[model samples]
Target: MISGIGNIYADEALWRARLHGTRPTETLRRAEVAAILDGAREVMTQALGEGGTSFDALYVNVNGESGYFDRALYVYGREGLPCARCGSPIRREEFMNRSSFSCPRCQPVPRRARP
Candidate 1:
């Protein structure tokens, strides 16, 4: 089953799935979609396993507790850091009024989608 995820989860899932932010859903094969879903599940599973997650001190849980899951992140909020799978630095861009992060080398934009 697929559920909607926020920007943070979407970024993490895309990074895990090695999918470009500008990638068109229509161009994705079944396996790629599966990978993205799996990535999302993995993130949620890990967060649930740890009770919850907080990106910063301001992101406390309903119980007012901070979780360590933020440290396990692969791309979210990690701009300019080396990608886990590739040595390329993760880049951040303004997307839909929010930040989107990805490794340039790992998730290259399709030529048609490039500005």
Candidate 2:
């Protein structure tokens, strides 16, 4: 399940790869999976370079500093905002007790059930 991935990075990577979170792994081509992994790596590398994502005061660095990467995010926590790739608004869905964000135009809902 895509729930194994954290909500924040998952949304960002999905947007980068133009994939829907509910996409079944069995339905994905090897190249698509690779691209998604690459997207995740790229975003994570960028996040690490900028410290990390800190949503609140409780999540602070060793120096008690909040990360600045939140401002650089494209999809996560950007509900109702325009997508960078498509002009569609980013939509948030409740999943596994948390939220999942995606561009409805870019990442369409899957019609087939996951294997």
lDDT of 2: 0.76
Model 2: weakest 10-residue lDDT segment is 55-64
State how far residue 88 of model 1 sits from its true place (Å): 1.1
Report the poorest 10 consecutive residues by lDDT, candidate 1: 55-64
Estimate, for each residue in 11-90, the C-alpha lDDT of model 2 and write its tens digit: 88888988998888889888889888988887777767775544332234323444554465788878999988888999
Residue 91 of candidate 1: its Cα lDDT? 95
TM-score of each: 0.80, 0.80
lDDT of 1 by residue, 1-115 (tens): 2225777678888888888867777678899999999998887777666755443322444234345434667887789989989888999988767888888888887667433
Estimate the TM-score for candidate 1.
0.80
Model 1 alpha-carbon drift over 4 Å, by segment:
1-3, 53-67, 113-115
The alpha-carbon RMSD values of the candidates against the true structure, listed in the order shown, are 4.5, 4.0
Reference-based TM-score, model 2 = 0.80
